[model samples]
Target: MRQTRFHGRVEGAAACCSVPGCSEPGEFRAPVTPSSFDGPGSFRWLCLDHVRQFNSAYNFFAGMTPDEIEAAQSPTAGWERQTRAFASNGGDPMPSWGDFSDPLDAISARFRPTAKRQAVERFSGAERHALGVLGLKDDTDLHSVRRRYSDLVRRYHPDRNGGDRRHEKKLGQVIEAWQTLKIARAFA
Candidate 1:
């Protein structure tokens, strides 16, 4: 096959140029009408020389107002138009990372189970009961559980409570619950 010199030349084109009185092979495409919302409109085949002439005379802003022309020429023209938001998270509420000092903390918080979820989904029956005994929530971390245990011990212990034997039974129960929860898989 013979190759034409121009970049957009139609290979093996048999149609004659659309330009009147021109017998050259129609190797280039030119728009027959302005494009619209429907589509790119129609095209006319032209020879190299005639296509160059058509291009030279074509004015993209021919019927546009000065303001329209200015807007079209602006760097941020197309960007000003609002675009459809992507449904990336399957309709989940978007995290407000700007409100957080560390954006990763916001993301972590979003994925982390809530106290209710932990109680229902993660903790076993005994673990849940132990958590209740320690006066800690199912969502409480190991550190918080340890702190609560220490606080309860101080509050109920005979030595810490000024040798009061009245709370010894409550203190024993607290200690037993702490022992059970300390080695629990949920806390670990």
Candidate 2:
């Protein structure tokens, strides 16, 4: 029925304090040996006064090397460890920001296909047909169209095809498509 001052005081504890020559009731627990990867080591019980003395003398960095102590005290101590990477969204891999001189342009590049689709929707049927005939995408710029037209001309032109007339029909289609797309407002 004795009143105890310490928070860890064990009621009805029969064990005597682990400290020699002390007869006080062992009411508080302290580790007798440091724990290891194998298991938690042993504990010994002590009275309130002895436990307070033990706590005042305890040093968590007691056996640690100077380097280990310094590392434990560092602000970024645990941040160097690698963590699980975020799962990708199954789309095109994001462009690395470091590769682009302009960060905003890198962000815009991710949404460019959607912007191209919106532009494609504004094109007239003839313009769209011309784009298809020239084997170009809806997002093709005038420069790209010109480059594609030149490549097609060199491929299908009878003079370039070793004077073979077999590709003359395809060559005429490419020229006509270029003519139509060149005058289209979409190219402008």
Candidate 3:
């Protein structure tokens, strides 16, 4: 039972061909030194016919500079300005906190007005038709429209319906619906 086809080789590697009378088995790697004072770069291996004669005389821009080999053969290689596209709502076009007083807090401020004053005097289409002619609603107030216009003027007062002058035209329409709810409470 023997099988052997070491493709890009390195299997259980204790490699050997650091090229001294090569006993073969080094499975290929290469650069043992170019410039690593003492850390990350070290590899020699080389046995597939001296790693194909050291990758046919490897010279990756060897001693660079013809404008560094035309800026390393740039098709925008390493893209000059680091290959654009970042602006998702660009930035720093200036406004980086020019006195960002917690969003212009104009000094210990307190602006409470997102619609109030009794919700703009309880919705006004003529104070909602004078709180529907005093049967009151729009959150009634002016002292509950003077207590529902004095209880509809004592229930259509004509001597309380005894001296009944036919409810005196319903007590002059409850005194003209309490003078249009006291002139719509001075404009609601």
Candidate 4:
């Protein structure tokens, strides 16, 4: 007795090959139609030899074009449909920064030290802050402000600092303070 393969075969009762004029026990199942319209699909129970013959002659890409065949072979062929990244948005879902009110600008401004000047015995709030920024004495006047501005510019200028930018930001702050204090009513 030969050992029969019932791996995919129906249990309990063996089906006979559906080929015309044949009496072999059908041990394997094949699709009855290349493309099926029915549910679970119609299948033909074929014997070993017939199923082998059917598989050898089957043309999976029978009527497909060359491009269609190539696309079908690609690994990413149906990935877009599966991912559905553009299903709702029609493209990327991320909003461009230009489209929204920038939060970074607001956040940076919040963290930045406000330029509000403090009230001093003589100078106003603005003048006090400016003096602090320029490292000047509260007793300093317009002439002293000009002199200090020139001196700081000389000391911190990139050219004077041997092309180092370390003090450039400080130099800018000093210049701004001088501009503010020179025109101040106290200095006038």
Clashes (backbone N, CA, C under 3 Å), per candidate, total 0, 0, 0, 0
lDDT of 4 by residue, 1-188 (tens): 97576456664437888999879888788997555565666788888788889889998799999999999999998875755344664433343233224557444444444454222245668778999987888788778788888888999999997899999789888888887888776654
| CA lDDT, candidate 1, residue 96 | 57
lDDT, residue 15, model 2: 90
RMSD of each: 9.2, 13.1, 21.3, 15.2
Better of 3 and 4 by lDDT: 4
Q: Residue by residue across 1-188, what tens digits does model 3's lDDT show?
A: 75466467676567788888989778767877765666768778878788888889998998997898988897877755656677856422322232222444422222433242122233446556656766677656677788887887898787877877877776676677667667653434
Query: What Cα-based lDDT does every candidate model obtain?
Result: 0.80, 0.81, 0.65, 0.74
Q: Tens digit of lDDT per residue, candidate 1, span 67-147?
A: 999999998989988999887766445445543445676677566655422212456677788889888886788898889
**Model 2 lDDT per residue over 50-91, tens place:** 999999999989999999999999999999899998778756
List clashing residue pairs in candidate 4.
none
Off by over 4 Å in 4: 1-7, 34-38, 82-188
lDDT of 1 at 93: 59
Rank list by lDDT: 2, 1, 4, 3
TM-score per candidate, chains pooled: 0.52, 0.40, 0.23, 0.38
| Candidate 4 weakest ten by summed lDDT | 91-100
Q: In terms of lDDT, which candidate is stronger, 1 or 4?
A: 1
Model 3: lDDT of residue 6: 41
Scanning candidate 3 in windows of ten residues, the lowest lDDT window is 91-100
Q: Could you give the candidate ranking by TM-score, starting with the highest?
A: 1, 2, 4, 3
Model 2 scores a C-alpha lDDT of: 0.81
Best by lDDT: 2
Best candidate according to TM-score: 1
